[model samples]
Target: MKLLLVVSNYPYEGHPYSGAFNERSALALRRLGHEVEVLAPRPYVPRGLSRLASRWSSYASIPEHETRAEIAVYRPAYAQLPLLGGALWSESCAYAVSAGEIARRHRRAPYDAILSFGLIGAGGIGWRLGRRLAVPAAGWATGNDVRVAPRSSFGKAVRRSLEKIDLVFYQSAELRACGAALLNVAPDEMDARRHAVLPRGVEEPPVLSSERRHELRRAVGLGEEQVVVLYLGRIAAPKGVFELAQAMARARERCPELICWMVGAKRGFDDSAKLARCGSVRLIDACAHEQIWDYFAAADIFAFPSHGEGMPNSLLEAMSTGLPAVAYAIPPIEEIDQGSGALLRVAPGDVHGLADALVSLARTPERRAALGRNGRARVYAAFLSADRMASAARRVAQLIETRGVSFSQFADRSAAAVRR
Candidate 1:
């Protein structure tokens, strides 16, 4: 099946981590024997060559179009105001840019369905593009779209876009419910069947052998005797980094061998100093995209105290690497971490509870091994494997094909029902 994926934020020149999850999904779909193209909009700042111009010159220089990972990707320029609801504005510009590409692609072969990520911006763009092309559009909801948007500046606009889309894909059950509340359409209009509850996939990372693990540890000057705990995402508030630090500070009293290898950064900012006071925590600088797997391999356990998440991709990666995790028993986190017995989850903000859990896990290496194995098995059996995600995508394509040239009938009736 041929697809046109529209996203507002995607990995571009000099930005390695941006929209990486979306890019991986695209590649996974292609691996399943489908053709995919990307339409990612870049922020444009028009100025009289001022300081902003000097700062954003790299964005303008980003290649307008490039084909990477065996997929054709296009980055169109969209003028945006950062602070105040730029997402809505980006969609309008994206629609204009996407229409031309859709037309060009349609001439070669019509896409089975249009796929868009990020419900706030790209969802509207995909809905508009689908309307123009008279095809079904599926919006993938993640992070800010479900969590931040409803409470943000453009709540109603986001809701309207969700209402208009033919289908919605949510990475977690929490997000699915959050979307319904945010969209707030009547039962008759918000058809649950139209939403696909598909968590993002875990592409098998480079398998780290026991020898490789030792090599990575030695390279980082970590002694073979120490227990390395890893926090994969941003080192910021809400991620509970400070709380994790406190937890470590307490846990170290019980097991002084515990050393946290803080990897990744907050928007590429290394506030490693935040955890400086924690004697047991080691502030490792953010690694390159390719170097992440080595950190996972080098670590003995994954500790994520994040208060919230949209499926926790980093957690998934760590789990797939066969590392036992200790995180919060929060929604979505609990959804993934529960029942498997692979994770030890404490209450959301209980530092002592978190510390106790970590110390217990650290002391019991046999239990850790058992949990790690179970976590890896869970990822392979139920979570997002490449084939699982591809299969979900294929099902959506099949649905669109059977639904015929347009999903306008469904959209119209739902809108009317919502109105009445």
Candidate 2:
């Protein structure tokens, strides 16, 4: 099957971590023996330009082509300020325009189906294109789109887009329900039969030698015998960075040798500096995705006290590296289960509970190691192996080919029945 995968974000030189999960899914689909072409609208901001000139130059600047994991990828230019309002509008318009061009070019050899990620921005484009081309369209809903955006006008527009798509993929049951609710559609209308829980995947990281681990510890000013807790990803409020800091401080008082290393970028360094005053926390600027494995391998544990998520890729990466995770027991986090790692009941802003969990993990190395091994096993069985996802994609493709129904058609039929 020939598939056109559309998304607003893609891995680029400056933002390699961006849209990696989408890229991984595309790779898995290709590995399933399907031909895949990624249609991405590369966003650009020209510096000190004649505004119109800047937009034109930025659009022209995008590479016409690229390859990722043996799949052909094309990036068309889109002029959008990265600000919230303009970005959303720009993405919708750019995708609609670019997708039409793609349809025209491939008119003689039309794509078998279209798969899109995100609802408000990317879904509008896919729905318009699929309607134009008379092909099946599927949309994947990320956590923020469902949980955070629904209260806004843009979010309502996204719900309309979802209503027009054939299938909505979610990472968890809660998210699926949220999507259905936002659309004001019955849960059954958003049937799990068509929907799927497709969590992200990660490659196993390289095994670090004891010497390498010790070297990393020394470089970070952590003692060889200390229990090092590592936090990898953005250091934002939603990420529970402040809570993690408090937890580290508490853990330090109990186990003086416990060290916390935060390896990620921060919008502000002031918070990190405040945490450093506790004398047990250190913050390093973000590391390359390729280099993240070493930090996981070197650390005794991975701690993320984030409040909400849609199956975070970082958790999977940590598990793949046999690093035990201590995270807040949010809906997506519960997917890890007891067999995978420790899930603590820390409310979104519960600093004390977060700190206590860290201390407990630090004191119990044997339990931590066991948890890490279990997490690795769980990841291999359920998340890391892309075979199940490939099977699901193939099944969806087969349905699209056999039914010959556009997503909007299915949605309209379903909605009509509901009204009747």
Candidate 3:
């Protein structure tokens, strides 16, 4: 099947890590023998005048089109309103700009399906574009897209788009339900027969031996007997970075050997100032995507206090590396809540509870080891690789086959969308 994938964020020349997960999904599809073309919208300014332009000028250096790992990617610059975090209307303008580009490209080689990597920004765009192309359109709801956007104007747009969209590709059942509520869809009607779950997956983790673990720790300047508790993701308020810093101070009081190492970039929230107060914490400004696992190797536990998530690549990668996770008890993380006692979860915003969980794991090596093993086993059994997500193309093809292909079905779906 041929796919025209529209994503709001994707890795560019200056930002190799912008949307690594989306890139991984594309590569996985390519590996699985599918023809995929990417239409990723980037905010940019003129190159020579970029320095004098707004904050979004950082992307000015990236070429509009490039190929990585043999996959064609089209990065079109769209007008953006700087500093308006969730400026709903800005996304519509961006979508209009990207939709024009996709339509232009469609004239040369028609695609079999259309899917958006993000729900709000790209999903709404896909809905509009799909109606024009008369093909299947689907959206993916990651953590912030559904969990955080509901009740906002963007949420309403997503809700309306959900009614029109032919399918919703989700990360978890919890997130799928959230999308249903946003769409005002009845619970019983929300099914795989309509919606599907595509949990984030990881490449098989590199083998780590006792000596390799010791070497990785020494390389990272970790001392012997010191337990490393790692947090890797965008530094955001909802991620509970500030609470994590406070929890580290409290947990260290019980297990003096415990140290918190936060490795991520300043996306929206920069808790570097708050984290400065904790002397036992270590900071590594976002490392390269290829090098993240080494930090996991140097760690004893992966303690992520994130309040909500679609399906965390960090949690999946860390678990694949055999690192036990202590995260917030959110619906999306429910599947990983393995009945085999794999994960330790605390309620969101419970700093003290996070500290206690950290302390318990730190003081008991056997318990940590057992949970880590269990977590690794669970990840392998379920989310083994991104290749699993590549099946999205097949699902889209199936939808096109079962629901719509000719003018009559397209007109029917299009009219239904108009009524919604």
CA error at residue 32 for candidate 3, angstroms: 1.0
TM-score per model over all chains: 0.89, 0.84, 0.88
lDDT of 1 by residue, 1-420 (tens): 778888866676566666788888888888888889988887776554423444355567667889887788888777766555555567676577556756666656777778887877788888887766666788888766777557555566577677888788788877777777886754345576677678876788787899999887888788977888888877777888889888988999899988887776543344555666666676766555677888888888899898888888888889988999888988877778668776777899999999998889888899889989988887777676586667677767766876654565555643343233
Output the TM-score of candidate 1: 0.89
Window of ten residues with lowest summed lDDT in model 2: 411-420
- 1-420: candidate 3 lDDT, tens digit per residue: 788788877877567777888888787777778888888877755455555643456767767889987888987777654545463544677676676557656756777778888777788878777876667787787766775566777777777766777888778888888887876776568766668787757777887777877988887687878998999987767788888988999988889989888888553336665665667677778766788878888889998888777887788889888899998887767777757666898988899999999999988999999989998888888886555665666677777796444435566655454343
RMSD of each: 4.6, 5.6, 4.0
Whole-model lDDT, model 2: 0.71
Which stretches of candidate 1 lie above 4 Å from their native place?
47-58, 149-153, 185-190, 266-280, 408-420
lDDT ranking, high to low: 3, 1, 2
Clashing pairs in 1: none
Q: Residue 419 of candidate 3: its Cα lDDT?
A: 42
lDDT of 3 at 274: 63
Clashing pairs in 2: 247-355
lDDT of each: 0.76, 0.71, 0.77
